[model samples]
Target: MTRHETFARPTIADKDFVLATDLDGTFLGGTEESRRKFYSWIEESRDRVGLIFVTGRDPGHVRDLTRRRGVPRPDYVVGDVGTTIAEVDDEHFLAPIAPLEAEIAAAWNDAGMRVQAALRSVPGLTLQSSGFRFRVSYDMDPDRFDDRAFDIVAELGLDALVSADRYFDVLPKGVSKGPSLLRLLTHLGVDNRKVLVAGDTLNDLSMLTMGLPAVAVGNSEPALISALEGMEHVHRAREEGVGGIAEAILHHKLLQ
Candidate 1:
C-alpha cells in the first residue's frame, strides 16, 4: 500500500451517499477558496463519499481533466451528457456500462448521421465535435434555429435539447440525464434519496428535475432557475460552483 493508503480512512455512517454534479459552471465555477475546501473535504472523506461527475464532456476530455487538473478523481463518471457511464478510480476507467449503452443504442440511429443529414440544410447549425454513440451535439444560433430543427429531430426519432443558448444536443428518444442517472443508481443499488445532483445550466435541467435533492448555483442559467421554480427538493445556493455545492450539502445534512 502507498503511504496515503496506510492511514485510517475517514468513516461515515452514510456509506450510500453519492454526489452527482455537472462540470463547467457548477463544479468548476466556484471561488478558489471554496474549490480548495470542497476538494479537501472530498480528499478527507474519500472512503465514505462516492463522487460522480455527471458532465457533458467526452470521456477523453474528462480523462484529461482527471490527469491534468487538480479535481479529485471521481468514483464514477457519467460523461457525454450522461449517455456514457464508466466506473473510474484514481488512475483509470475500469468498468463499462454495457447494458446502459445498449439501451441507448436501441434508441439512437447511425451515430447521429441521420439527424445530421436531415439538418444539413438548416442554417446556423454547426456540428460540434462531441458526437458519440448516443448523442450528436451542435452549436447553433437559437434565433436562426427554427421549429424545422425540432421537426427534423422528432421525425428522426430523436430528442433535441438546447442549453446555455448555444449548445444543441440530439439524443436518443428516452436517453437523458434523468433517466440515465436513475438507471445508473439502479445498477449500483443505491437509493435515489441518497444521491444529490448539482448543476448550473439548462443541460442539467433533466438531472435536477429527477426529484432527487439538488443544488443550483447562484450563477446558474436563468432558464434552469426558472425551470427549477416550485421544485421543493432543489436548493438554490447563494454561492456559485463548489461553494453552492457545499451549501447544499450542509442544507440537506447529507453527511449525517
Candidate 2:
C-alpha cells in the first residue's frame, strides 16, 4: 500500500471517457489505418480520455506491449487475468496495488504446484511459458482438451476459464478481469458511468456484463456473443476491434 498510495499522477477523473479495454483483439483489432487514427485520437485527447489495459497478459508483457510496440500506454493496467492490479509508472514499470491484491493472493494460496500436479498429463493443453504468479494458463487445442480439467480446478476451489476456444486459465475463485477493474475504479473514485468496458472473447465476459456501458467487438468469439445475447447494456458492435470500440464510444454517447 505504501509503495504507490502516496504517488501522484493525473487521474481519470479529469477525463470525459475512460476506456477499460482488453488487448489482443479488441484494442489492437481494426485495420492498421483505423488503429493509427484511434491511437492518435486518444493521444490528442489525453485530457479528456483515459486508458486502462485490462487483459490476461502479465505485467512484463503489458510493459513490453506499450513500451516497445508503440501502442499508447494505459494510465492503469489490470493485468495477469485480473490477479494483478497495477499502475504504469513514468518508466512503464508496473507498480502493483498491494492492498487491492491481498484478496487475490490469499485466494490463490500458492495453488500453482497443486494445479500443475493435477493437470500435468491432461491432453490437448500445453503449458504456456509465462509462469504467472497468481494464475496458470495453458494453450488449449479444443479437439483433445479434457473437459475434466474444469472439474479438477473446481474441486480445488479455483476457477477455470476457457476463452477464444483456445486458451485455458486457472484463477482464484471470484477473481477475474471484471471484479478487479471495478475494484481499481472504486479505489480511485472514478465514476462508473463514464467508463466503457470492451472485449472480444469469453474471458472478457465477466467485465463486459457487469452492467457497465460495454461492447463485444465484432471480432468476438461465438461463445461470448451467445452469452451476451439479449443483454441490453452491451452494444454488439458491427465493427471489429478498435473500430467497434470507436463505434461504442458514440453509440453510448459517452463523449457527451
Task: Choose the strongest candidate by lDDT.
Answer: 2
C-alpha lDDT of all candidate models, in order:
0.83, 0.93
**lDDT by residue for model 2 over 117-216, one digit each (tens)?**
9999899999898889999999999999999998999999999999989999999999999999999999988899999999999999999989999999
Per-residue lDDT, model 2, residue 216, is 94
Clashing pairs in 2: none
RMSD in angstroms between candidate 1 and the native structure over all alpha carbons: 3.3
Where is model 1 more than 4 Å wrong at Cα? 1-16
Task: State the TM-score for model 2.
Answer: 0.95
Candidate 1: tens digits of C-alpha lDDT, residues 167-237: 88888887877778778888877767778899999889989998999999889999999999999999999
TM-score of every prediction relative to native: 0.91, 0.95
Could you tell me the lDDT of residue 19 within candidate 2? 98
